[model samples]
Target: MRIRAVGTSALMIEVEDPLAWFAALDAARTDGRIDVTDIVPGARTVLLDGVPSVAALTAALRDWPPPAAASVTGDRLDIPVIFDGPDLAQVAAHVGRSPEGVVADLTGTAFRVAFGGFAPGFAYLTGLPWSIPRLESPRPRVPAGSVALAAEYAGIYPTASPGGWQLVGRTDAVLFDIDRTPPALLTPGRTVRFVIA
Candidate 1:
């Protein structure tokens, strides 16, 4: 792990495993070991905002033991999905499974929210056993609520927009709402599951 200053306040910690580090940092904050206002996690980094003293925090973090591999320590959400998509057969073929089998596998596995990007409320979920490839050509627009897979991540389109993922299903659950307190449904580190609708 490496900590770098990110202006007058805030420290960006680069780590091999972000979720584990995130859990550790959150614990520090909760236990009063660190004073910070926000803990923002990314794919490979965790940003500590509102730091009182960067120097002090840096020294403290260095002396602290490295975080262990994290289990799913966040809130769990079950999303109801309809497993019927244009690329469902393609995904099955790629994995050498029937469509029903594909759905079974997807629902059976628990996914973790690795990060949020590409669109508002669109979370890059990790935990697939196999990495799936992106479509060669980007689609003009993927419908809102489309559950798609790309690389090792599974994501839902919060709003209709152009996308390049392999669509495998969709959900009616609202992924983002400006009126909601936190907005994004799938914040980093949250455990997610897809259930047949």
Candidate 2:
């Protein structure tokens, strides 16, 4: 693991495996060892914001053991989706599979929330191995609950927004709500599953 300064009160911790690092951070937070205001995870980095001191954070992490393989110990959310997106056929053709085959492939695998970005409540989920390219021309606006894939990650649009991911389905799950204690339904390290409705 490598630690670097981020502006004034933030530290960026880069690790070979970000999920493991995030797991370790979660454990530390549960044990009341991490006092940072926010912990944001990326593909392979964790940004610790509002840190009291870099030394303190480093000291805690130094004694923390590396996390085991990706495990879904927390809540596993099941999202029911209807496979009727405009790009469903195109995605199936691009992947050399029928629409049913494409849906089967997606539902067969378990996904984990790797990180949240692009928008609020928008989680970048990992586990799907097949590569799906982004649209050459992005849509002016994609509706909320749109299930889409880009590169190697699958995502659900929390709200209507302009996007380029190839949509394969849509769900009715409320991914973000201001009144909720946690505004975003998906967080790093959470387990997720997509199912046909």
Query: What TM-score does candidate 1 get on C-alpha atoms?
Result: 0.91
Q: Encode model 1's per-residue lDDT on 146-170: one tens digit a residue.
A: 9999898899999999999999999
> What are the lDDT scores of the predictions, listed in order?
0.91, 0.87
Candidate 2 structure quality by residue, lDDT tens digits, 122-162? 99999875899999999999999999999999999999999
| Worst ten in a row by lDDT for model 2 | 64-73
Off by over 4 Å in 2: 59-65
State residue 167's C-alpha deviation in candidate 2, in Å: 0.6
Best by TM-score: 2
Cα error of candidate 1 at position 122, Å: 1.5
Instruction: Give the TM-score comparing model 2 with the true structure, all chains together.
Output: 0.92
Task: Give per-residue lDDT, candidate 2, residue 66.
Answer: 69
Clashing pairs in 2: none
